[model samples]
Target: MSSKEVDVQQVLNTVGEPTRFRIIELLSSRPHAVGEVATALGALQPQITKHLQALEAAGVIRVHRLGRRRVARLDRETLARVAAYLGGLARADEDDAALDDYQRAIAREETRLAEGDSTRVLRFERDLPADARSVWEAWTNPARAAQWWAPRHFSVRVFDFEPRAGASIRIVLAEGDAEYESRGHVERVGAGRLVFSLAPVDPAGEPLFEARHDLVVTGEDRAHVRLDIEISAVREDAAPAVAGLRPGWEQLLDALDAFLRTTP
Candidate 1:
């Protein structure tokens, strides 16, 4: 029979037989010759051979010739396939449970929002270069933002960017051949504070999140300025994104600091 015609359930059923089950139980501990299997089960060699043949045909056990002796062992690939199938089924069940929980949370949040409840806010703060205009221009200028905005593995592509309020900006990040885009409108712009709302350009981008940034110029020199920043975003699950942002933001700020120190 073709391998596809050999049903996994049929193999399981064949191995479930009393004699075959005992043989499998014995082999579970260790591989053994047909004679050893017979001796362990207190059966004749021929009787063990019959069960062994059936198991081998069902792809449950494999027999290898060793000189004058034949050794049998469980077919590891078949056993692994069975285990993986069961694991996938369990994962599917767990996903169903999580989906139900998410649906309930959404319904509860909707009811709360209908009553005009506000969103939960998560916050972060940082210190930047001492130059106010430099920090402002670094953040507002597409060229400067592109230099340090993205993570190490990503490069930014800013197609349309205007620092003025109500202008639209589209930023694309490229990682190898994979790309992610953020599309949003500039909501507010102050002396050193900028607020925006960004949504992923594609359906595959992360769910809705908000970006709020506040840059405060702390001090200045003839050609240098000190600035501090408070960047806050509301993400679906803030923990992982927050953790990732910590390092990325630090690196970007470091790059910006270096750029300002050397730039004329």
Candidate 2:
């Protein structure tokens, strides 16, 4: 009856098909066009299209027009919703059994990326059920930003934050006993968008790699905002760092959504 409640049987039935499950695995890293999906699955275009459409209709995959191409990407929030439901039911046996399958699915994408399929830039776009102003405040305000800037399992400490062009922005990301300091300067700052250059530093304060993060927020309607996050300037050798950027940011965005949902 609620947005978060999903038909468990429906999810099980939809993912039961081997082809659909494989399609979901293929999209774990990045979005794929219909042709790309066909090539990845070695199936005919029409067949893959039908599978994708089914997944899209089931809310597991989202199909959107990116420029002239229709691309399908995993709807992580929807997946997370279902995962939360399953976890709440205390399905430990099923969860334990799924660990291996999940790892294998992720390994397929990692293999592809390792074999010279490195991406120069990582991009993500999501529509949040929050206003642009709230989203902007959550990003620019130091305390709010600290709440969700790091990945789900990590925490962030904002040492120096000035959300203005040419101002300093420094943060320490802590995961357990390990910590990394990132230093950067804000390049451009506006009402709904912000751009900055960031780099991780060693103990000696030497830069690891130069990177840039650009975020744009668009007011979609009275109660929704579309946010675009892009990371670039990733060095070739540092490809591994950005490799997990997609899922890293996805979890952070989920954190942001949770923050907003509770705060509102």
Candidate 3:
């Protein structure tokens, strides 16, 4: 093979076995004859020989005739290649921001899941550089909400919304030619708080689950927001939606934060 490349996975599989790893570790000190290696590890000669043959096939080691006995030594170049391959994988993860987001969601995991095993509760908090009044408008006003209502990769069209007890709420989120509808009503809306229930419908026009949102905004010159979401009435086919709820809301909140900062 090329000097710059090696079958690292094959070498891993070969050395991954316990006995093979022990044999390689034994040889690392210096080349050893087959019988000497078996004697060092207290393993049978035939078993050690079989492991040595697999390692040889994977280019992890080389066996040579030393006078009358056969001796095996590690191939330094192949082992170096495996180290570089693993280093590259570690660097790739360092550049991924989504991994940080997932870590944040995991940190917020509840002490105990809902008793019924059919409901999930999620909580999130963000501090935004805007007053509570304007942040409230961003959520309730269609003209303002349209700017940052949907998550990434979706555009929202607000058809109806009334900020009062028992008023109707409806919005359509479109991703290219595909459209989704969310319908519900306000439980209460006042000052800097909104309590509402929303159900995002599926393709067959069935509600996925009932999500009750208790969003509260505080602080004067700058807003401190807290949101508690409880999801229930989960339908059988709502698996994907349930899994995505935390990430989806994370994106939406980020969008709102950006929109409010840049708005006139």
* Sliding window of 10 residues with minimal summed lDDT for model 2: 222-231
Count of clashes, each model: 6, 0, 0
Ranking by TM-score: 3, 2, 1
The ten-residue window of minimal lDDT in model 1 covers 222-231
Higher-ranked by lDDT: 1 or 2? 2
What ranking of all candidate models by lDDT puts the best one first?
3, 2, 1
Off by over 4 Å in 1: 1-124, 199-207, 222-243
Task: Tell me each candidate's TM-score.
Answer: 0.44, 0.53, 0.57
Error of 3 at 70 (Å): 47
Report the C-alpha displacement of residue 177, candidate 1, in angstroms.
1.7
RMSD of 3: 7.3
Instruction: Summarize candidate 3's per-residue lDDT along 1-264 as a digit string, tens digits.
Output: 564557777888889999999988988899999999989999899988899999999989999977989999998888877887888787855226665765554433321223335577889899997998888888888788888888877888655778889997888988899888888889998878899988788767678888999999999889999999998877655655666678878888999999999996
- In model 1, the Cα lDDT at residue 16 comes to 85
Model 2: pairs clashing at backbone N, Cα or C within 3 Å? none
Which stretches in model 3 have alpha-carbon errors above 4 Å?
1-116
Regions of model 2 farther than 4 Å from truth: 1-119, 220-239
- Per-residue CA lDDT of candidate 2, range 33-114, in tens? 9899999889999999898888877788889987988899998877877888778888566445444655554565457556
